[model samples]
Target: MSWNRRSLDRPTRRIALAGALFCGLTSAGCIVIDDAEARDEAEEVREDLRDAADDIAESITDALEEIGEHMSDFAEELGGETLVDQPIHFREFYDFLPERAGNLRRTSREGATGGALGFHMSVAEAEYEGRSGAEVEVSIADIGAMPVIGSEGFVEWLDLSVDEESDRGWARTIEYEGYPAMEEFRRTRGDRGRAEFTWFVESRFVVVLDARDVTIDELHELRDAIDTDALADLRDREGR
Candidate 1:
């Protein structure tokens, strides 16, 4: 009978030791010992963790959204889209050309489209006075849709080195009615000659006047004849 009592006491002591060990591991005032209460506390902890994760995700999303908005605003301020996407009306530019440049008379006028190349051009032919069969061609090209040509770097590229001895001929920078311009004059041989005046209007459209058998003075006069203020007004209307 004493042996049976000792065996029962040993089993009861082992069970009590296991319960104490579980309580020590949990350290929650032994409340984890109750199955239902422990399940409720675990669910509450899971809910709090989920809420914290959701808040973190929301914060990240908001930050990204704000960054995107700022980038869009910056692009707009640079006139990147407005300058590149606006359609070029060739007629408006054609009208800006004068009926005559000095003694030269306009012989022909034509409009050309570049299609997929994204450009519009107006060409005018003029005959030099007192010079039989001698002609000059003046062309205005709108290359705003082209990224490289319309960019700020284009202005730098126009700053060509002026050297009469070089094959490229004489290239120089000059101001045309307050706008930066490039003038190039080249003579291949004999009396035959070529001259050009190129400039960017409103930092968008590219205007070029190419003349055959025309003097530098005549080209300058032609460049000055263009109505720059009218061109500015046209660009403003389109941007709006």
Candidate 2:
């Protein structure tokens, strides 16, 4: 039987030939093969290949578009990159904690890395004690790029908007250096005693400062001592 392949691409011709051979084999020892039947089978095979290619290309394009939109929304919420590299080592995170800030002496330091409940993180932290029972605790946690599934994780505070106050304390969400932060202030023996300021930095690191018997200004001072620019440079920090 005569076969025409001049109008077809190389792959189409190869597949069409295979289809025709299968059709002939199915005839089961027939003496003569029908030319029209061979042509019809080849055409059908060519159409199926073209349809499959179109479907794959369409699926890929749709997937890419969806991913782009998803990442954009995620970045807007995070105020940084949608996806970063692996988390930095906890030892490296410790280097960001200050040993002393305006007379406060570091009393303790620790670092560790682990995962639980669908999340992984590396943490480094230190505590500083000053005169008059005042103290500051600083910590940095690297949570890597993968968003924690099955739980809100620590970032649940980012989605909050609380502004509550009483005679002795206040808890609210405030803005710090253009970042939405969580801060709480309470009075113990004096006007202002316990304080907490926490924020997510560089889209991957969580910076939290908890203090006791310190004024708000003192908290900000200790915060200013941390090299935030250097901390931000640690974005996408890669490690094991």
Candidate 3:
């Protein structure tokens, strides 16, 4: 029991002290670094996300502006009386628009790969084509929906008569780079003497007609006589 102070200090005691000190220091250092690094990383991620969001917002705004400008041009062309070739009243629904396109109603569709976006424009003739070759000369750009082409809708007016159930619409041969690229559906009501032609641009469908007191039978004749080739040619010209 009468041992020296130095000899009383056991190896186990020394090792224990060293281990505790090492663990304490290591843990303290780790805690400091982990917290700071975590905070920095979180901040960086937040900044990146914010930047991406801003870019996306800006892009969407730009696209909306562009779409709006195009729609305005289209409306102007369609609104113009010269294009209609008849003194007619127009009913426009442009005010009902998406938030992005300013004042044009734009709709987006989801597809497996991508999606489609579109707008609508409907026009009616004010006067009937008197016994003459009346034409609606819309710019290929307006209806074709080309990126950089004409900015007016085309015109078509005819005074041809055909039998009931007869397929005698206007005939014209036009060329397009990738046509049949689009399709045109025509409907005529012979009794009503009214004809309606529809052109679908991707998702946007434009219905063109000259139905001022038109009979169904007349519509059928006009439907049958829409110049498909002429439309194709108009589209081709836009490419040039």
Candidate 3 regions off by >4 Å?
A: 1-36, 80-240
Model 2 RMSD vs true structure:
25.2
**Worst-scoring 10-residue span by lDDT in model 3:** 107-116
Model 2, 1-240: lDDT tens digits are 001011112322233233344444434333443698886776666666666555544443343233334434543454533244445767886667777788677876755454333234555667788877888867676655435311243245356787989998888877776666778889887765998877666556667787899877778878888777788777756767
lDDT of 1 at 96: 72
Candidate 3 on 1-240: residue-level lDDT in tens?
111112212321232233333434444333333488787876666666556555544443343344445545654655432222111111221221112221111122110010013321122122224222221211111223322123233222111222233353332222223221211223343322323333322222222333333443443344334344443333222111
- Models sorted by TM-score, best on top: 2, 1, 3
RMSD of each: 34.3, 25.2, 31.3
Error of 2 at 94 (Å): 2.2
Clashes of each: 0, 0, 38
What ranges in model 1 sit over 4 Å off? 1-84, 117-133, 149-152, 155-169, 187-192
Error of 1 at 68 (Å): 29
What lDDT score goes with residue 122 in model 3?
A: 24
lDDT comparison, 1 vs 2, better candidate: 2
Q: lDDT of each structure?
A: 0.50, 0.60, 0.29
